[model samples]
Target: MRSIAKPATQHTITANAKVVDQLPFQDRQAYADARQGFIGTIDPLVITDDSGRVVWDLEQYAFLQDESPTTVNPSLWRISQLHMAHGLFKVTDRIHQIRGFDISNMTVIEGESGYIIVDPLTSVECARAAIELVYDHLGERPIRAIIYTHSHADHFGGVKALIDEDDIHPGGVRVVAPSGFMEHTVSENVYAGNAMYRRAQYMYGQNLSVDPTGMVSTGLGIALSQGQISLIEPTDLISDSGQELVLDGVRIEFQFTPDSEAPAEMHFYIPEMRALCMAENVSHHMHNLYTPRGAQIRDAAAWSRYIDEAMRRYGHKSDVMFICHQWPVWGTDSIRDFLTEQRDLYRYIHDETLRLAAHGHTMVEIAEMIEFPEGLATTWTARGYYGSLNHNAKAVYQRYLGFFDGNPANLHPHPPVESARRYVDFMGGAEVILAKARRSFDDGDYRWVAQVVNHVVFADPDNTSARELQADALEQLGYQAESAPWRNFYLTGAQDLREGVRTDEATLGTSDVLSAMTTDMLFDYLAIRLNGPKASGRNFTVLVHVTDTGETRLAELIHGVLICTPVDGHADADTSVRLDKPTLTGLALGAATLTDAVSAGAVDLSGDDELVYDLFTLFDTFSRSFDIVTP
Candidate 1:
């Protein structure tokens, strides 16, 4: 009863309809490319884990088959239709791809006697399903190698689903990845993981329904699989640009492209098949320089250079180029054209943004002013299906110059709730602002209405009129959004404003990631959890020893900061705690308390066990779903 979602307004429908005329809706090459190399798929196309909990259901996207509805963006609908194509696809004689199983594609390279899997999907269930599909079609073969092109979770998280630790040893399934893979993977998905996952729900519309007025596509794929995500450390690391490897008798040359799309990423070329894999560096649509879900801002300039490098190295030699997401490009000329446009897409966004910034324009001004050139504007691959010109332009500015807009007034602005109250008061109170916002909403100025009405909601979240009006404004914006993330964020925010926050659907399972962490990483994460205020006046020391890893860390709580460092032995400490790495991992994962571990004989605490207990008490447990649309 709390849900107040409405249909698309005339303004939003008219705005989306105009996009059909502005862009090349008649271009069917993308459709053909998407449907190319299609094999058989599961009849129902629903994946589940051992518990029978459904992980992915392609049936939800069945609504995407029809004509573009008035409630959805036409350009986005066109891509969503492409994303709905589920099944195993034969890319070439030696290559096959399992697409629409997850956000990223799983490329199966037929080796001499086994298979080489590259970039498995986000979850264990999805990866297992993909492998099962491969087994059903091409027959079962030992997995010779698993290649992780980048550090993103979607690429490597499902590794355990395919193979275990035994398979990673020598003469077994060799796990290979780019340099700094483990470091970036642990940092991105572990250190800031909780906050990122919370924001990701909004960006991905995990709470929204899959209907014409709700989530249609992620711009990259249908959706992220809701299942256990696992990780396995790589056995081989590729650092150099020209590094080559022979896995299962297949010769592959690599081009390391770090800090482009991900912190540790590479583009590989299969010389034997003459097929290039660009990883996530090149997708069908424009990618985010700064993703809305939150992470390090990607290097647009570096991203462009990687594509240019890939083009020079494998452009003419390759007939088909497959990526981690979306569809693949075939034919030399077409692939060349695709790479050229894709290269210019990021270059243009990066170069022009800095150019505008140097002209005394602020980040906000640059975002509004920047626009793609005619050639790129018309190119289907250059469209902002995931990333938008507005936000990406701001990202470029944020990269070169920090968040401060070079104005003192802009610096040190009040926090959201405080600022909203002041803004509403200055604008002559809530009712007056709502009246003005309604007029702007009627004029189809949904952006302005959303912006102004947001202040009213934050100032007084209980105001039903202001909340409904803001929800209406955000809903209209969602309908007009070409970027699925943008649409999702708008719609989710609108939903939260109406029905309140839904904590039930929050998906963040980092225990597998935690178990894979090294002892040093474990301590680093523990230090992050230490509550400063709680330990301000108290100073103590605890020496931790992990018997399994042979790692001893001296954790000192001094001046409200938890500092951890490796030591030779347990000396110069008030207390000493000894446990296996698994027990420590369980403690870090909140599976058990220090007292529980000690009572169960999993931990051996000497000297001052109370001090260790106190230290554990100081660690703060974070909330998975914090308020976003409200204060």
Candidate 2:
């Protein structure tokens, strides 16, 4: 039968029951920790934008209070329940945190004069609401400084909401971050933003129905805040470890952990407050060695070492350890134990994956073979709620040995659709394969059923029977997934199979993100959008002069690539466009057309106006809601 979502099969129910049996579900430490310092929260904990659009609504997850259902993983259900603890909470007498407002936590440290804000949530509205909660309860204090703990958007995107742009100057509230923050931030969030943002929908399950049968939690937090994401460049950069900064009588010692969780990240210790902020390095569950949304493979070994260093440096002295996600860990002993388990979690994954690979194990085989030690396995914090061991083991393999597994047969294989067609033909056609897959599905082998039936569906997407069966298999897999993203991917795949891709949620207005881009950065992003085949054998040169910034750039599209260079002047330029940076950014971001800008006196074109317009035509607009489950 065709269905939107199916109930968990007996196999799935039994799988979830095994999870409850294996783990220490009776331990209430996480629950107690989540609610330790709860001051007050707006009942329903809803944050809306100025237009009344709901950005974050914790009330939707009111279903979490019920006992774990057969359709949901008990471990994931446990984390999702803990995440419902919303509002401003007192971490210590001098420290406070706004939790469950967004996917990430925003901490407020009371300085001698004002307040120090660390890692404001992902959206401006959510960050603003979080701070307002602090103001409402703790009384308003001047924001003395803003500290960004990492390069992730959730940590720094809401800077503009907390402090004014005019207040970013010297002798004003200082903004601090690790070195290479802007470079990584723009490259990850802008250059490859279209693809990353698209994958993020599936990873975060932003469009999934909220219930036991769909998205429950992100494994890290309840949900991502749907408000506008904004960023302000940091004034002060933390370059080296052991770096110290005293802002408004608060001393922060930084440990720069480059190429760990993020391309640019750090962990810092507040000596006076006795608080150590681990950033996103060590969280409640297993962190991603390779995030599904796509990025460079993170170094697992380096990730473990960073945790070890932080524990040695600050674990003893710290009264409380706060992370960018989930609740904080209190007491020196508890904090030390938490850090040790987390440290070993990454280390074991790294070491064992390599050890198995050395013994001639393929990436897929290594993923299946590696098992965590009992100590790391049983710990609630080490479990894979976000990043699973199966994917991470393969990630480490990819990082070291590359995608090739030394099998010449896999050196170059047919693409998905072609491969599926051949596989179906070899297996005696679609109906025959469906018969076998149904038996496997009935026998509770959903993973194998999903894999085999996928060939039939891809070979012929119009086959209703194949699509329905595949959807059923995926639903069963989703019901049994311990990792939130895994469940989202499986269910969302089933969703795509049933309902087709929803294209309306594809575009996000990135005007604020574009405004923060430097002239060079903007050109770099423009280059990424340049369709090589479209630009092939067509050459052009455009010289852009920003009237306000006095920055000039020469963009040459030749040999199927776009090359940009900073130039003071280019007399031989094919076209020279004089416009303000905002006007140029607006044109680049497709917010304003060249014809409109030129007519409105926003742009002045000296030569080859048609050529400039043609240059834009070579750029391709990316679809944010591309089909993933299908070709």
Candidate 3:
């Protein structure tokens, strides 16, 4: 509900159609020919399940006007246009799709009993619309099974709309996903949920308005689902690289490929039909090197290995390979070509970055210098969508070598804001810096404008002129970015520079995430966020017992911090905190603090509150910006 405020600009958005200087026009004839090339280019409309209820309408998205026109990248703008153009398109016979649904395609697989859905968009509302679209044209079908190829929210958030509480049963439809899927899915977003989601706003341009100039695509596709998120526990977990399972009479062979996109992800082949479901493993666009949203760095080497394995295992045998989004590659040659290009794209980034790193290029230096070679670049599918070559190569280096480049000079350095002010002071005055930035801006070299303006904006967040110019520069960069995420990040940075930090209160915050966290994941996420410097030498221990679940654990606070220790269900300890999961969630959300919770009688503490406070002191808060991009 909160609109992050931006410095007043001459630009205005009216309720009626807007009037602004349009950029270079795209050739409609060319795009129409492209549409003709792709058999089902225009998505068919099929709204459903409102039972005459008007829940959502994608028709409005058919056209969009940019809000931060001057700040976004051009490449991202083009993709954004495509993203806006996305609608419901047919995938195959008996299968209908709401293409560009929730940044990815929602595939409706027809089954004898009902429909076997793969990756149900991002929320119940959107998934319902997509399902309705399928039923509107292809006849109504019940949902028998849901296959979650990975743990990402977009792929499985719509489970509730498809099947309700009565669905997860013996005779109820099966929910399939990767091993550790439920645990990882809940943990990934739960632990660092708030900050990550906030950063994701910038990363995916969530709040930035859609216009020719405001926000565009997320390199991967359109923007993320700002609506509610839901998760369906996978009834089937595929753990191995090669595994077979039949869901609702559909014979599916899954190939587990973890650590590429999400920590838990996979792809499966429908052998009898000679059709391969690539899942999100191989899409029409390039994947991200490192996501803008916070997460553990993905392994590029392992990613390449799994892609190759999928090709060797399923490429030749399949007639058509349909991905989770975009379109499908019909025929063995088409699928093989697509797989070969994608595989080499990762391989190229991995090997070349290692070679450059061996030659003593630092991560930033490597990212700047390394480019996707012809083998990878000539193929449009390898273009940065979800992942870009710049970040991915650096991720490869980070995976193999630690953040350090073996240089002692770079071992410890002052933070960027502090260092930027000093650098400007050394370079003379802010006037001189502004002059140089002006020249770069005039050259239409937005990247350089952003780089130089960084000194001023970071040095002084209150500098209105600096914020305005920097945002302006970023808008232009967003306009040019080929990747949706790159555009989103660029525009988001510009927005933040102009408007200030937009902490999404309407959305769930960090403490809220902490409260819902399970005992296991809470401890793990706490360990990561724990500030070691603050917890120097204090030590204490507390035993926790979930009254409702009867789960017990011994949490030790040593060296001024809390650590997870062996606490069996029967373990005896000094103090115990008795509360239900929701009660803990309330405490996590800051709705109730330690003292408040205890005073409210919601928390039953046996031993000293001082020790608990001491233990709480052991946990560290995480930093939103840890310098992933440029140091």
**Highest lDDT among the candidates is held by which one?**
1
Task: Compose the digit string of candidate 3's lDDT tens values, residues 164-259.
Answer: 757789978898898877777778886677578667877776667765555545656565554455665667789997688777787788898888
1 or 3: which has the higher lDDT?
A: 1
lDDT of 1 by residue, 124-154 (tens): 9999989999999999998999999999888
CA-lDDT, candidates in order? 0.89, 0.89, 0.68
Q: Model 3 TM-score?
A: 0.85
Provide TM-scores for the models.
Answer: 0.98, 0.97, 0.85
Q: If both were scored by lDDT, which would come out higher, candidate 2 or candidate 3?
A: 2
- The best-first sequence of candidates by TM-score reads 1, 2, 3
What are the runs in model 1 whose C-alpha is more than 4 Å off? 504-510
lDDT for model 1, on a 0 to 1 scale? Answer: 0.89
